[model samples]
Target: MNEPEEGAAPDEAATRDASAPGGLSRRGLLGLAIGGSVAGLAVGAGAGLAGGVALGRARAAEDAHSAYGFFGEHQAGITTPVQDHLHFASFDMMPRTDREDLISLLQDWSYAASRMAQGLEVSATGAVGGSAEAPPDDTGEALGLPASGLTLTFGFGPGLFENEEGDRYGIAAQRPAGLERLPAFLGDDLDPQASHGDLCIQACADDPQVAVHAIRNLSRIAFGRARLRWSQLGFGKTSRTTTTQATPRNLFGFKDGTANILADDAAALRDHVWVSTQDEPAWLAGGSYLVARKIAMLIETWDRVRLSEQDAIIGRDKGEGAPLSGGDEFTAPDFQGTAIDENSHMSLAHPEHNDGIRILRRGYNYVDGNNDLGRLDAGLFFLSYQRDPAQFVSLQRRLSTDRMNEYIRHVGSGIWAVPAGVKPGSYIGADLFA
Candidate 1:
């Protein structure tokens, strides 16, 4: 029944089972199977290729239904396994709002985020349950969808504490000293509209729609208390936080984050990623600093270059992602060997050369359509969590002479002081307000 007619158009045959007279379309059949309305019926049989494709899709659907808890010792998205999609938004508090408004906004956001993380609606009176005469609490796009492993992580920017208008929140003194604007880099061509905010929320999930929905609902909840400043949508995560996952390639076609800090490495997280009581203003004790960089890759130019030069710039073989000097992808790089370029990306960013400094990376590749020049306005959305802003600044400075710098430009940048995880009864950032 799944096979096509003896002689139908190649496209139509693959898309529909035309041999079955007056039967349901191929899409209709698959929809019923995925929705579990037709459990007995086989979805993709007879055709080997089609069966494999259907099986792969079924696995993805199952993965999307998974959920993550919102309230924890630390935010889930930081060390949580990296999700495939990202909807990261920056926001600024309203000018006339006071301390109470900021506090209330965090409370409202926390409530909704906690519920949504469990695959529930923003409110009990969600999309359909709300009064017909009034607006629905939820937007309804994710009504039938699972939580998709959604995780919401919030942060406070430098402006959140004390902007040009002065300390409106009355907690300016609690701001971490390291939570300031990122300094200028060697090849910066930043866009003011896409950079900086008073507050930021990072929504990540396996499904793109779920990630977008999380951000959309949060923005609606903000209403008059805060307004969206800038946002970036990213797909195809460039890094993984777990050992089970394979190393994902970046837009540059190199296996990125091969030596990234894993979630299970508590020592590394303490030394490099998480904040400590000994370090600073005390309110942000269990928190971490987040650095977001919109690194625009010049793909057109990079693609035209020869493979060997490309490998040289990245400091790894294109095929196995192994160091040019030696062994496999996971092997420790031999910096002493002359085979690897001294200015290559690996050498400069490696902890060996940078006083054993490391940052937990959670980056993703993004494509924002195309620019007016008929060029792709796409690149890697580089995100890193560190113990201090200085850690990232130091590493980025060391990469000033990176050979890969010629093929990329840093366009958007921001840094935020991410507070510790939210306690069950208390709201996010309640420590600072206390």
Candidate 2:
């Protein structure tokens, strides 16, 4: 984690008062200070100013309604109640960057992320208060908006420890044994441009604007130190981490994550989700491995298929989302049943077939506009967390014969070592350098 810099706010409490009545909220003031425009009010002079102040207070109030704590035992996005929107990004460290520069960048990023998660500006001075000649510290697009329960989770890719040129960061020796590139899968049509990165950030939120705003500001902070390799904007969460959340449907109109590991399942999380010190290079004790796959659904072809064929392919009832063998959404699949196809997605992906193994899935459906032929360029952006990446490898290899592969193409992929969460004064990844 990055050290708290000179201008960084020490804690969320030091940032701004969420209950204050009629002053410009920190975000509003920061936005106005930056280049954001205030609407011209029709009211008289004093009323106009009061109206502006009220607007700021209202914005703060909305933000306070759904804020997530930034500092915790583990990162928020992974186990935090699944958010409605996602902005996932991958970045490559600039050439010749060293350890100190990388540490400074992480520190700066942590500072900014902490403040933003609490609905505060990146810094106390913010955009307007700095030097006039210099560019504003914040981009200011999220000025009047609430934090929207935003969570920022960071990760280190394999390339971060040792690049093609060599171990440029010197910390390659500390790389966890589980941190390595994923092997090519059977039907992977992976795009190199979107495949790998030195670093990644998964920002999820209840509001789309808030999610995008967080990534935009973070990308700005990384300006010279790193450059964006690929980014994905996703909506309509395809999984439920908490039991309270109802299972969400993917773009295929089927309920996804029916058998996913719930956040409240402590035993499941410890056994399958979190990495232990015994399994790693000490710093990654409470960390997790993230496997991201940009799977593009062949919507046109899938739509043309008969409903029964589609149901057989997924091994679930389209309306009720139950296993073809019978019972409700949560019922275990009876793979032995003749009705359930042996090559179906449910049969192949079930824990019974993969050595009783399961990973925590937090995926989202994405539609990236149209393809050259005008069909929807969209599918499930699959994101899963596991204690060891080998678990995923094992499970995915078993899924090689899945019938659902016909309707999807693996277009982009990445795997990263998500470090354990930070303490009060520490920044993300701080343990690595320790």
Candidate 3:
């Protein structure tokens, strides 16, 4: 649910249907079915249209700070590919004041989100105010719990805020890593003086039903811990749309999810995340991470690329994110590997290509169907959370330039100032942004 420093994550490497035991385990279930299963995730199928209308007044008058929740590790276990019982869910939270009530409300939300993720539609609409009532048509359907193939996930947007920590968040931090492998961006620890942002939790379930519940439930926990406000948002598993394809199909059609970065576990952190090389935030010690990016793709321009040429430019198989230069999915490109046309693994095709630019990409793929223009439309809701977006932006300006630049375009963009973890009632970024 949470946007990565870059964008969306991949479905393949993502655990879609596996469950690990205890806190350190993978999400219960993960992965999304490519075929009919897509239909099963009727994301907008709910009375969302109706809920919008019904909850209008109540939502307008509801006490923004009166509701909240928080509960971590009450149950501990990591599940991956959470089956179809899973779906990505998140809240468009609004900052509020009252922390205690907000926490309790989140407790209810946690239970609600958790239960719903398991295929139990606790309420007609997961709305915050007057729309809380379950509609009549949703009776059987809303009440029905998803069985098999469910995966759930969630995210806390910038809107979420707490008292003690301000904007600072809480998450277990790991030490700095991969300095020797310095990405083209900073070459060294970029955030030599920054701290980890506040808490951000993620979960995946197999079944779409389960995914929704998992996200909502976890969201509740977040609310309980801090005085917060929220609203549900997001879609099912993300894939390419037609407008985004080489021929204008699927989100920017250049074969999606290929550039994603996957860190298998705590060990992979150093290689993927970033940390300060010198004395930094003592509390931030051992905590090294990146707020990749959120760069919107220009699908219309991206569709102009000829299919075969697309493959050659990225120097990897287009369908899968393998390097054309050589290597399997997730394998670091052999910068020295032979190129399709005597090119280097990380060399820029554009005249502006610069070896000095290197960025760790952890973005996701998205398809926001045809816009009002009726032009085939789609693009990445790209996000790459990095120690410094500057590094990524600099490198991307170069990468986005190569021959591939014509195919994709930078349409929407945003940057968030993230911080380190904090104790309950604590705010984030108190020392810095605050």
Highest TM-score among the candidates is held by which one? 2
lDDT by residue for model 1 over 324-403, one digit each (tens)?
98899998899887989999999999999999999999999999999898999899999999999999999999999999
- Per-candidate TM-score against the hidden true structure: 0.85, 0.87, 0.47
* Residue 432, candidate 2: alpha-carbon lDDT: 91
At residue 357, candidate 1 shows an lDDT of 93
- Candidate 2 lDDT by residue in tens digits, 248-316: 998888889999999889999999999987886889989899999999999989989999998999999
- Clashes per model (N, Cα, C within 3 A): 0, 5, 165
Model 1's TM-score against the true structure: 0.85
Better of 1 and 3 by TM-score: 1
Per-residue lDDT tens digits of candidate 3, residues 1-434? Answer: 11111121111111121111111001100011111122222223222111222122221112211111111211111112211111222233334434343333332343333323323333323322222222221223222232222322222233243324353232212212221112333112223112122223333333344444455444433432332221222233232212222211225333433333233333333433333344243433323333322234555555677776666765657666566656675565555535553332235522225543333332344454677876554444343434434555555555543554444444432233323432222222222222
User: After superposition, which runs of candidate 3 have C-alpha atoms over 4 Å from their true positions?
Assistant: 1-96, 117-142, 147-265, 270-304, 319-322, 326-364, 383-402, 411-434
Flag regions of model 2 displaced more than 4 Å: 1-65, 131-133
TM-score winner, 2 or 3: 2
Ranking 1 against 2 by TM-score, winner: 2
